[model samples]
Target: MFRAIRLPRRTLLTTAAAGVVISSGLDREKLPIYPTPNPPILLVDSPSSLEQQIGVARRTVVGTYDNAYSKVQDVVSNWIGVEKAVENRIKSLHDPTEPLTPSLLYVGVATLSSTIFTRTRSLPTRFLLPPTFLVLSLNYFLPKTSTNISTYLTSLEETYLPSVAEKHAIGRAHTAMTWERIKDFTQESREKFGEGVRDAVKNVEGWTGLKLGETLRVQKSEAVEVVVGVTKKVEEKVEEAVAKSFVEEKTAVDKPKEVPVKRLV
Candidate 1:
């Protein structure tokens, strides 16, 4: 049993009065007083306000995207225009019908040098031939070849590109038509497949007096079981074969070979 210690009412009142007196006697101005913290303010927007904010954000993003796209398009158009201008300038500078005389002359000199170097067994002449050929070709042949190539390309572009573009357009149209035909065929096939599936379900329902869903569920379960059984048997057979092979290998490795003794004859 627990005993409770009780204080007299007069004594308790005296203690409380003393505490209040002591607290009041202390200077309240010197005591630190902390201010109470305010609760966090949560602003919840209504549906209309939220939708308006979303619309503003969407408009900003779309405006940015359009600006960026337009800038890129401008840059690409400017680049294409500059490229065409440069190409036209180059085509105007070079004549396509210009003679290949310098290039031919360099080639002949190189060939003659090679022939002379091969026929003559003179070491100094052979040594001189290569450098001479190099100088002649570099000074004459390369520039002439480059000019001829540019001229040829310009002529070909002027003559061939339009016809080639027309052919490409025709091919693209044919490809589009072929794709449309393929799409129609696939759609027809899908419809036929759906009809066949519905017909099959009706036939099954009529024959078995059971719902097609139930029949399909039953069949699926049986197929799963059969597949599981076959897989188990195959797994067992494979494990047995592996174990047999491993044992055979281990025995072959462990078995000692007999050493043949040679007679001293």
Candidate 2:
């Protein structure tokens, strides 16, 4: 019967590191588009403005020193765990803890191991060499690989996230400003409309010579009739002047002008 061995969280993290390295080699344009982090409402306005806030949050959330230390710790711990797993896998091949049956497969493996032992003069090289080589190789390469992954991820965040965050923040601010402007305009319009209505009411009251709740009784004022008669008389005088000018022009045109005759001398 086989029992399951639960892998540590560090193992999972190391596996993820491998994935990240693989992904970094691929075309970045083909990567998924992700949205930026949004803080609570009204906290941010633009990217430049939010930089200070982000810094404060970073320091306060976990102290600067602590955060950095934890990162280094995680990297070291993960590498150690990964190297240990590699050692175990290698060790299992040569010296497995499980019982071995006398089957053809076992016989062949044993025969191969004995032959390798004879060929290699070094006793440690016969059994422990492969695991030691693997541990050393992983120790050297994993740090570099993981560091590259971290750098790529950091660059991605810097390139894409800040712009998105700024746009979102500015968009929100603009929306709020627009709403305020609209409300102010609406209020001003209502005030002006009310004033116009009041003025109209006053003008109507004065024109009709009536008060509020009064019947529609239009008084025939002789002043208006007199003004209209005066305007009509003025118009007639202007028309007569125009007609007289035209008549004088026609008479002047009909009158023959004496032409000077040049004598050929």
Candidate 3:
């Protein structure tokens, strides 16, 4: 009983250390890592890895999805001057009869930013698709709430952070992918993304507080777009792999067992 509580604390310290180490390996190409402290719930690094260790793959997919999201921020930031315009244009495109409201614009940018960035970074797209589908289904079926605070707060977060993240994604991906395209952009990105990375590192303090039972200033509720997005993604992947294995097993069973080959006389 005494050791159980201490185990989690020790694991957190060890995981945080591991995060720092793994993050260090990720160059600016994968900079601004979101550190997590749960060593026990480890995430998989790639699809091949997931195939190897199905359990760990579930966790790793979430981490990889996080990597995908960090890039989403980069894409949005790059859209700065153009993001607003892009957001506005898409909103109008979606609504032919009605005038685009600020609210509509907000959702538009969030969806568009995520969509476009996902195209460039298909890992997250393939990863995010099922989750987005689930959340949209949830919103459609369960959106009604009896309370006002929940509604108002949800509205507010949906507006601000997605806009912010979209803009950030644009900027950072421009740097990372640009450098990825032509190494010349590497120096350019280090200078530009430096502030973004620095700010990202600084933002960790607030989220860490949430884990410790402190309130997140930004109403992590909106960030549910991120949380649910990521969670749904990882869950779907694990489920898919499991389903695939079961299908394979069933296929083998349905077919006649192979007869042992006899050696030729």
List per-prediction Cα lDDT, in the order shown.
Answer: 0.80, 0.69, 0.66
Question: What is the alpha-carbon RMSD of candidate 3 to the true structure?
Answer: 49.6
| lDDT by residue for model 2 (1-265), tens | 9999999999999999999988887866475688757876766556675898898898786787898999999999999999999777544433232333433344455546555655656775656655454444433434443344445555665678977666766887999999999999999999999788767767988898667323322233456677899999999999999999999999999999989999999
Q: Give per-model TM-scores.
A: 0.27, 0.21, 0.17
Q: Which stretches of candidate 3 lie over 4 Å from their true place?
A: 1-221, 260-265
Q: Compare candidates 1 and 3 on lDDT and give the better one.
A: 1
Q: What's the residue-level lDDT of 73 in candidate 2?
A: 100
Compute the lDDT of residue 147 as modeled in candidate 1. 61
lDDT of 3 by residue, 110-220 (tens): 556666656766686757864575445434333442123244554565587778666666887889987677776777788879777656655775666433223443566
Candidate 1 residue pairs in clash (backbone atoms < 3 Å): none
Candidate of highest lDDT? 1
Better of 1 and 3 by TM-score: 1
- Show the lowest summed lDDT stretch of 10 residues, model 1: 92-101
Q: How many clashing residue pairs are found in candidate 3? A: 24
Instruction: Tell me the tens digit of each residue's lDDT in model 1 across 115-196.
Output: 5766666887777777677656644656654565656665675577977766766887999999999999999999999889
Worst-scoring 10-residue span by lDDT in model 2: 212-221
- Report how far off residue 127 is in candidate 2 (Å): 66
Q: Return the candidate ranking by lDDT, descending.
A: 1, 2, 3
